[model samples]
Target chain A: MNLTIKATKNNTFDAVVVGSGMTGGFAAKELTERGLKVLMIERGREIKHIEGYDTAMKQPWEIEHRGKTTNVSAEERWANSRFWGLGSEEVVNHLTNDKENPYIEKRPFDWIRAYHTGGKSMHWGRQSYRWNKQDFEANAKEGIGIDWPIRYEDLEPWYAHVEKFVGVSGQKEGWDVLPDGHFLPPMPMFAPEVHFKKMMTEKLSRPVTIGRIANLTQPQKVHTDLGRASCQYRSKCARGCPYGGYYSSLSGAIPAAMQTKRLSILHDSIVSEIIYDEQKKRAIGVRVIDQHTHAVTEFFAKIIFLNAGSINTAALMLNSKSNRFQNGFGNDSDQVGRNLMDHQLGSGAMASIDGFEDDYVYGQRPNALYIPRFRNWGNDKQTAYLRGFGYQGGASREGWESGVNADGFGADFKKSLTKPGPWSIRIGGFGEILPNPNNRIYLDSEKKDKWGIPMIVTDAAFVENDWAMRKDIIASAVEMLDTAGFKNVTSYDRPTHMGLGIHDMGTARMGRDPKTSVLNAYNQVHDCKNVFVTDGAAMASSSCVNPSITYMALTARAVDYAVKALKKRES
Target chain B: MLGGAFSAPTLMAMNHWEQATSPTIEGAAFSLSDTHRKIVAEIAEMIIPRTDTPGAKDAGVPAFIEMMLKDCYAQSEHLSFTEGLASMEQVKFLELNEAERRGVLKYLEQQTKEKMKAMPKGTPFWRLMKELTLLGYFTSEAGIKASFDYVQIPGKLENIKLKPNQKAYAY
Candidate 1:
C-alpha cells in the first residue's frame, strides 16, 4: 500500500500537458517558468534540437528522387493530401504516413497531420499574423456562428507576451485589418515581389506587405539565450533548422521549459483519456498508452492541458468517457467534436513578367508577400460572403522546372536551362470557412489504429458561403496578377478539401455558454475548470490568418490564468 | 575500320563514353542493355554537350537515370520507355548519324506529345527520356557546381542586381 501510494505520488505533478507540439510547448514553458512542475506528454518520438535533423543539409545530388515522390509507397503516403511539397525527401520524415494513419474521409477530407515531438511546427509555413478586432466580432456581427466569448483586447497582451518570446519577424502595418504585434526586423522582399506589391496596392487599392513570418531576422538577447539565431537564408526549415533560425517547439519553448528544471517530458506516450473525478467534478488525471509498447499508464495532475492539435485533442476528449460524463470528458455541452472549421485554400493565379530580367534575389527569403483581407471589411461589405480572405504569394524568376515544356536538346538549349528564365508572379487566397456542426470529426468505435486508439471519421466540405467566397478568391488572385501588368496570366483552382490547409480548428470551441461550447473564455473546460485546451481546438471562429501564433498566445494566457487560480485556491 | 567493331551510333557514343568512364550499374529493379545504355548516354551528351563546363556524360548521368527508372518509376510506366528504345532500335537508331539522330529525336518528341493526350498518369517515351536526362544531369554535382552559381548558405537575403550571363541559383 505504501509502495502504491509512492508510485501514485511519483506520477502526480502540478500540470500534465497532453502534447509537446506548438501550444503544448508554450504551455510547458509558461507553466514551468511560472514555477509549476509540468510534464509534457507526446505520442511521437522526441527530437533533440539540431542533431535530429537527418537530411537538413543534403545536396540535390544526394537525394535519390531529386525532391519528387515518384516512388509508389511515397506517392501513396502523400496521396490525396493535395499539398505539393510535403512529399519531398527533405521533409518526408516530418509528415505522417497517410496509409499507416488512415482517417475515414466521409467527404474526402485531406487530413494532413504531423505527430512528432515538435508536431506540425516542424512542417509549418511560419506565416504568423494577428487576428484583428473584426475577426473576433465577425461571428456575433454576422450571425454565422456562436460569438467569441473574448474579444481581441482579451488576447492582445497575451499576443504581445508570446511574440516577445517567440520572436515574430514582420513589418508593423498600421492597418486595422491586421493588427501589428511585437516583431523583429522584417525580411527584405525580392525585386519582383516589391514590384508586385507596388503594382497591387497602386492598382487594386489593397494592402500588400512582406509576409509576417516567425523567422528571427535580428536575434535578440531573449532569442540568442535560447540558442536561436538569425535566419541563414538556406530555406531548409522543413528538415528542421540546425541553426535554430526558425522557431519550432524544439527550437524555442521546449528548451526554455527544460531550463526551468520544473519540466519533465514523455515521448511516445499517447494521452488516451482525461480522467475526471466524480466527487470533485473536475479532471484529476489522465490515462496514457505507450505508442510502441501499448502499455497503459495513469498519470495524476492538478491541472491538465490538451494541446494535441485540433483533431487528436477532440479525439482524446471523446474517447475519455466516464460514469458522470458518459458522453466524453467535458462533453456536458455535447459539442466535443462538432463545429469543425478549416481555412479553404488551393485556389490561386500565376503570370509571367516580361521585363526586369536584369535583377535577381541573393538569398532564399523563405517568406512570401501577403495581401491582407479587403472584402467584407466595414465599408466594403459584400452580400456574397460574410468574412474576407487574405492572399499569400510573391514573384520570382522561373527556375529549371520551367525548362520541361520548352524545346530543348543541345549545348545552347542546356545553356538556356542554366540561365534564369522569365520572372513570374503568383498569388493564392486563404479564405475563411464558417463553422458548421455538420463539418466535424467523430470517433469511429468500429475501427482502431495500430496503437489501439479509435480512428477519426472526418465529414466536412465547403458549404454555400464558402463556395461563394472561393469564386471571389480565385477571381481576386487572377485580377491582382493580371492588373499588375504581367503577361500570360493564368489561374488554377486545384482540388482542395477541408483539411488541406492543415488549420484544423473549432472542434471543441470556446464560447459564452457551457451548453453551446466545450471551453470557456479562458480556454478552460466549463464543467471541468482544472482542464484546459489551448490548441486550435479552442478556436470559436476560423479567422483568415495563419493560426499558430494565436495558439501560442492562448496557451500562454491559459497557463497564466490556470496557475493564478491554483495559487488563489491554495491561499 | 572502327565501325566494324560497333554500330555507327556506338562509334559516335564511344567518343563521348571516354569522358563517362564510370562502370555500368546493374539496377536491382530496372536497367538497360549495353547497347541501349550507350544510346541513352549519347542522347544525354547531345542534350547537354561538353561546353566550357563538364556535360551530362561526364557527370555520370547514365547510372543516375537507371537508378531513377529502377526506384522512382513503376515497371508499367517505364515499359513504354524501354519499348520506345526498342522502336528506335528497329529504326536503326544505333546506325544513325548525328544529324539523323537529331531529326529522330525531334520526330519522337512530336509523336510523344500527340500520344500524351491518350496516355494516363505517365509520361510518353520521348518526353520521359528528355525529362529523366534533365533530372539526372541538373541534379548531379557537375551540373550544380560547374554550371550554376551554387550557394550552400547565403547569409543575406537582399535583392542583388542581375549581371550579364548570370547563371541560376542552385539552391
Candidate 2:
C-alpha cells in the first residue's frame, strides 16, 4: 500500500488550491492577487467560460426529445435524476455521473454535484444573503454544537468585498435577521409578488423583499472591466449564462484569477491525499490522479487550501493518513467528517390568485422574492423549532404547458394554452438543520474508486428540530398565502434527506479550541496551520441561508490571513 | 437558503420543460408499420386539425410520437398502442374522409373519457396518443412560432398588460 510517489519539482507553488469551485475560484483569485503563485486542481473536465456552455445557446425546439431526459439517462443517472431541474438533457451534462462517482448512503441522501472547472458555481441558485449576527452566536446560545469562532463583524468587511466584486442585486430592506450588502440594481418584482409583500407586512408583520441575488441587473464597472455583461432576463441561467449575466465561477473568479497571471489551474486532476510532512507537522503537497490516464503526480506547495466542497474535502482529509496524524490530516480532534448538516427543505405552501389575469411580466426574471426568517430571531423565539427558516417563493401567470392535462383539443385547446392562465403564488421554506455529531461522512476504506481512492460513505438525516421547523415552514407559508387573499391555498410537507439542498456543510467544523474542531477561525486546520479549508467543510454551523457567498468571504479572509502568516514566516 | 426555496412557484416556469416527459406516459420501443403510420398521422391531425396554426400532422407530430413511443415509452404501453392501431385499421379509419375521421376520433374520445372514469390505473390509448400529439406539436417550431410569442432573450423585464387573446410566452 506504500507506493512511493515522487513530487514534481516543476509543479511547486506558493499555494495549492484544491477544487476550482465557488470558494476555490475565490481562493485562486485572492491568493494570486496577493502575489502568490497558486495552483488550482479541478477534478472534472475543463469547462471553459461561455463557449463551454453547450446548452445555453440551444432553443427549446433545437434540443433532442424536446430537452427531455432520455430513458437511458434516467437509468444511468439515478442519483441526479431525482433532482427536478438537473436531470434534463439541457442541464445533465454539467452534473457528475453517479455510476462513475459512487457513494454509500446509509439513508436516502441526494448528493447533487458537478465536478467540472466551475463545479456547482455555474448552476448555483445565486441567492446571496449575509448570515445575521444572531446566526453566529446561535450554537453557543442554544447549546447545540460548538460556537462559531468568528462573528458577523469579523466577516462583514469580507462579505462586502465579495458582494462588490460579485455584483449582487437587491433593495436595502433594513432587515436585521438578514443583513443586506452592497447591491446592484434590483430586478423588478412581479405584481403578485408586490401584493404578497404588502399583505405579509400588513397581516403577519414579516418582511418580504425581492431576493438579493448574484444575477447582475446592471453591469458595474467592476464586472464590465472583467468583460461580463448585464442580465439578459432569459432565465436560462442554470444552463450556464453565456453573457456572464450571473456570477458563476466561470464568468467571475476564474477570469479574475487568470488576470493576475500568477494562477495556474489543472483540470481533471483529482486530489487523492495531502502529503503531510511528519517531521515538520504540516502539509507539504498533494497527490493527484489524472482523470484521463490514471497517472499519479504530486505537486508541492508552501500552503494548501482545501476548497474541494464539503463531503469531498472531508473525504480527502480522511484519506490523507500520515504516521504523525494517523486518524487523518489535522484531525487530532477526530472532527474531520463529523457534524454534517444541510438545510431541511421539501416543505411549503402555495395558492392560486383570483385576479391579475391581464397582468404579466414581459421577460423571464431569474430571481424570486424572499421572506426573511421571522421565527426564533430576536423576540420571535419559537418553541417548536430550535432555529428559524426563510421563505423563497414567487408568483407567475401559468403559461401554455397548463394545457397538457386539460380536456379538449384543436383550436379551442390551442387558444386556451396561447393565453396565460390565472396567476399563482407559493413559498417554500429552507429551514436550518442543527448539526449532530452522529450525522457524518467517512471514507469506505474497503471500497477503492477508479482512482484507487476510498469512496465516501454518508450517514446524515434530518432530526426532530428539522421536522418541527418544516411544520412551521408549511404553516407560516400557508398563513401568508391565505392572508394575501389567495384562493385554493394548500400546504405541503414531504420527507427529505440531507444533500438535497446542495448546501451540505459542517463536516470539518471551525472552532476556537484545537482539541474540539478541525479548522480555526481563519479556516486553517488546527494542528496543521499550513493547510486551510475555506469551503463549506469549515462551517461550524449551517445558517438558514445560501452559504456560497459566506464561503467566498471566508476564502478571501483565510487567504489574506494565510498570506500574511506566510510572509511573516518568510521574514 | 432563501432563494432556491421557491420550488413550487418555479414549478410553473418548469411546466413547459415537464410537458416533454410526463411521468404517467412512458414511451416504448416499437417500429411503426407503414399502414399504422398513416393511421397515427390521421389521428394526430384529428386531435390538432389544421387551423390558423399548423396542425399536429403538419408539425411532424406523428413522427415525433413514433420516436417517443419507440424510445421513451414502456413495452406494455407499446403493445397497447399498436393493438389500438390494429383496431382502428379494422374500421379503416385512415381511409375515411376528413369529416368521417373527425367523427371517429370524437367517438374514441368519448370512450376514453368514460374508460378513464371507470378505471384510473390504465390510461386509454387515445388519451396517450393525444397527449403525445400535443407535446410534439407545441414543442415544434411551427407550433410555437405560429401559436405563441417566441423570444430567445427579451433583454429586459417589462411590465405588460396582456390582452385577453394575446399569445403566451414560448420559452
Listed in order, the DockQ scores are 0.55, 0.44
Off by over 4 Å in 1: A1-9, A70-72, A75-81, B1-31, B74-76, B117-121
Per-residue lDDT over A118-201 for candidate 1, one digit per residue giving the tens place of the 0 to 100 score: 898987899999999989998898787789999999999999998888888999889999999998999888777777778877
- Report clash pairs, candidate 1: none
Docking class of 1: medium
Worst 10 residues of 1 chain A by lDDT: A1-10
Query: Backbone clashes in each candidate structure, one number apiece?
Result: 0, 7
Error of 1 at A510 (Å): 0.4
